[model samples]
Target: MVDKPKFNTALHEKDGVNQPESFSASSIANITKLRRKQPTATELVQGILNGNKTALSRAITLVESTNPSHLEKATNVINQCLPHANKSVRIGITGVPGVGKSTFIEAFGKHLTGTGRKVAVLAVDPSSSMSHGSILGDKTRMEELVKDENAYIRPSASGDTLGGVARKTREAIILCEACGFDTIIIETVGVGQSETAVHSMVDFFLLLKIAGAGDELQGIKRGIMEMADLIVINKADGDNIKKAKLAKTEFNRALHLFPAKNSGWQPKVTTCSAINHDGIADVWQIVSEYFEMAKGNHYFNAKRAEQNSYWLTETINEQLKSSFYTREGIAPLLEQYKKAVQNNELSPFAAAQFLLEKYFSK
Candidate 1:
């Protein structure tokens, strides 16, 4: 004999009518007003200097925007913030997929925040080919760090950037520093050539690896390994601990084979368990030591100087290419030249020269 409890079906039913709540109109009007009132560059800079996260976020959005008006505003804001930037230590973290980069970042970020460091993580996510939108799932993955008061996490779409980083990541770093974050972590999308892009912009570049995966250097390129300032063998817990140690040993040996870095510092390999929060402190300690050594040798400032020059040249080249490609008569001419080249009617070099001459003639 079973007794059945009565269920209320009426409560689950919704009336075929729209309900309006108090303050709805006012809220809508206020949003409309706010949208109409774009803040000035001075106000945005002041908000950032005062550590207003909302202002920092909006400023970053402006920087990432392709709109001409937004670009002009973003440039103004960056110029105002430049004097307050460069106070933070920028660290780049990269590895192949399934290397637990998100987990490691959560643990490492918590450790830094526990020591009273204000940390900001800029995670670049792969863009969807069809939608051109970021997966934007890193915030969910780094749950612990996302909740920390001393931590700020921003996920950006990689867009068409070949390095698996957002085009405006360097500008985002400036915004983070202007907002008083002392440690900026740039997490790349773990794709080809991303490590190179990140290394150019960071003070320390870290590569995370795993163990028991056939060859110790399975998916990673040797050139990427050479760029790492610190190599960490993660997942060093339980059954994988011994394998992690062996991988660390192998990495150390391989690092020794590379030429010395310009900073005069030797790259180090260590092991850690991001899941268990083991050996995280050791990695931070190594970073601090490297900073001390590099600063003592004046390489820190010199590296930033070189990175600035590199970006300046890269920007000029990009603008020149953009201008050339977007000229009024270039698109149609380019299409014709492309067809001719594909049909073997014109050699590639001759087609290119023809296009250049046509472009210059205009």
Candidate 2:
């Protein structure tokens, strides 16, 4: 038999010309990725509807992008996904730093997924002042939940203001909901106005606190306390149980002082030791009761509608403010006006009005 030359694709060249298959695997992958076109908004929306986490993440990244070019695509994706959203129960969880927010969320999320619920956690991490990037080191705390097939943990940087991070997060919530997460938990950075912003966006606002953190009744953040639908005292295991019980009682009394919530459901307080998975079910029970009552009273849908309106206005305000400052000729004029105001050469309000008029004149 005549010997036929074996073709070694990696070793053989096309008449002294190299083909893509001749390149190393890593190089081929890199080149292929570079050559691939980005997915269309419709494609992303379809992927999200089909429960694709990767596509959901890419869409979220697009939503969070600062590039003006991405805004149009992001808006399109959000609009398409909106019809599939508003189905999940949004739970906002917040507390002061070191209050075991991450740990508690990890436990709570696992419990939820065990019940056959898909959980999406928008864990807003405090941004580094110098680098202004996500400090996701704490993501390790949710090691178990991170590996859970039904749970999605997204750690985002809390930008300079709640407007930036919260806005992107609100969009992310819609995407997660469309991607089949039945339970959406937004964990705030645990400081500043982030809690209030989160409270507005979620169906149930949960305030997680540690025992003996202060008066527990009045020393807490009053604004957020008023917004909370439930208060959970975490880390109640071992020697902390007694203190957690006392804090729970104090918080219950504190809730009584605030007028009944518009949801017509009285806020409840409970204690949990997240490390041991203690009392975790009780917390979910309280949340379930709240949902049951809200849905029965038809308040749930009404509240979401109100929130939608609020966010619409909020987005407009943020964009208008951004547009004003980012407009051409506004930066130099703003700087001059700022220096003038600092030197007492001009009134702040007058300068602001002039800047607005200048911006509008364009």
Candidate 3:
């Protein structure tokens, strides 16, 4: 028999009894000392430009924060990074629930990273009422991509946003692009108007659908289908392969009925098994071809310019609403108006005009 080595352990005395020591004040102090100070906006911008993941994450957090003080710093960071942005390809992926979005993203991200492309996935998850945070964690689902050195995954909470995207997602994209991520994937919450919001921000919108479900066409809105630049029937392996093919054919026929897109690019439908990594490259190839065609026709730059103008107007409207609603007197007045409207004592238009008058007078 071989002799076993004995390892020394620190002991602590409790009630005249010896126990293995778990923690020490000195160790806690050392940990506190080792914690890094928060980087300034300028430092974050410089660090992100240098491809530092930690700095990029910190900058995103700053942008996501609702804190009034952090807003200026976040704006500064985005402005500094704006010149470096727009160099990467932005793709939006959306689907109904249980459509294997995480699995698809993991495989898709791996494929891009394998080709030496730095990929960043911004996954918007449904928010919780209790915590007001994202509940569907993407990190655990995307195990492979989570471990990939070239891949970055962020799960954002769809906090009261009907479109299933975080308010600061656009700013986050700029930071990712500044950090040299060549491929950016925005995964929507897959409910309500989220698909439209994602479509506005991304260059390519890919809608993932499953086959064999009787309600396939019924569940997806026709508007979403029209927005899709490419439709993919995921989970096509084994028994599902035949069904997936049929669904693809059905979608192809349906797409032809819609009028041609302004970009002059025809939408394509295909099938793939995200779990088995089948047709992943074909999806990327299609995306590449779309980019090539859009750029050739100068539609890519034109679309982005339009999107910028849209966001500018959107930001102003949001800020105006926020400023008005958050005034000290607004809440009480709103409660009073709510009762009056419910009792049919005051018309909604009159109440709204009254509130606006009161707000401006103050």
Candidate 4:
């Protein structure tokens, strides 16, 4: 052998330490400095497509970031990635706690992976951050699916968005698609009401239900039930098998009470045991059928186009609101105007006019 460096150096030897693997104080400083420089939008998009998970994560952070400095960069990143996005089928899954939403996703994701599809699970556990919230960990529940190379699990707190789905999840889905994931699943905590956020973004929306819940109708409102492309009865094995079947029948009947979600496809309700992996294939079949029908009718492309328009309008409205609120002296004027209105010194209309006049004066 050629003369080799000493192979017996101590683990803590600074000189012998691998530079890239170093977790030293200086390493963190270097990372901070690198982040501060902030890669260009094109470079960021390229890194995301090249499968740099860190870059992808950081890109999403930039999207969700509230910082004014990151906003322009985030917009550029989205614009750059838009052409490479919207190729994947986006699915939204929501259910009350104990309905095994994560467990079902795990089983379903494994089924998709078995078929050579790259699956990405973006679980939004809105209840995770609360002071007294129960079931704070959706990721922990998805243990088996988490280990698969073909699957990506990103468990995000719902944050200020109440539907257990991140406001930025739409952006996250685009990032996932650009990273080569074919199927993107968004899981939400079901608080009964319809999750307009989840419904608006996904091509297919699924609702999960459990058996023997006396307040079955109470748990899911009509508006949400009306939006479901499919309803799955999870935990269908063991003692609840019969109950699960019954629940499916009930849902099917209830589904008929509401009009069909789309002209070509009627929502179907199925049962599954995610723990035992029972009926998981059937669930996938139903989802595939829905996709086929939707795609065949050309509604798939149309829907995405409509969603894009919605996103643009919504983004513009938000930006306008932010600009108005943060317009230099607007806040102080509004404060003074609020006191004026309270004392009947000015009407709400007049106060608004005053603010508008001051805003446009500059």
Provide TM-scores for the models: 0.88, 0.88, 0.90, 0.82
Please report, in order, the local distance difference test score of every candidate based on alpha carbons. Answer: 0.90, 0.86, 0.90, 0.82
lDDT of 3 by residue, 139-240 (tens): 999988999999999898889877798888988999999999989999998865646677889999999999998746763447888899999999999999
Show the colliding residue pairs in model 4: none
- Sliding window of 10 residues with minimal summed lDDT for model 4: 127-136
- The Cα error of candidate 3 at residue 295, in Å, is 0.7
Task: In model 3, state the lDDT of residue 33.
Answer: 80
TM-score result, candidate 1: 0.88
Clashing pairs in 3: 163-194
In candidate 1, which residue ranges exceed 4 Å CA deviation? 1-26, 129-131, 219-221, 335-351, 358-362
Candidate 2 runs further than 4 Å off: 1-36, 163-165, 192-194, 215-221
Q: Which scores higher on TM-score, 2 or 3?
A: 3
Off by over 4 Å in 4: 1-37, 127-136, 219-221, 334-362
Candidate 2 structure quality by residue, lDDT tens digits, 4-109: 9886888676676555665598988898997587999999999999999899989999998988789999999999999999889999888777888888999999
Candidate with the greatest TM-score versus the true structure: 3
Ranking by lDDT: 1, 3, 2, 4
TM-score of structure candidate 4: 0.82
Instruction: Give the Cα-based TM-score of candidate 3 against the true structure.
Output: 0.90
The lowest-lDDT stretch of 10 consecutive residues in candidate 2 is: 158-167
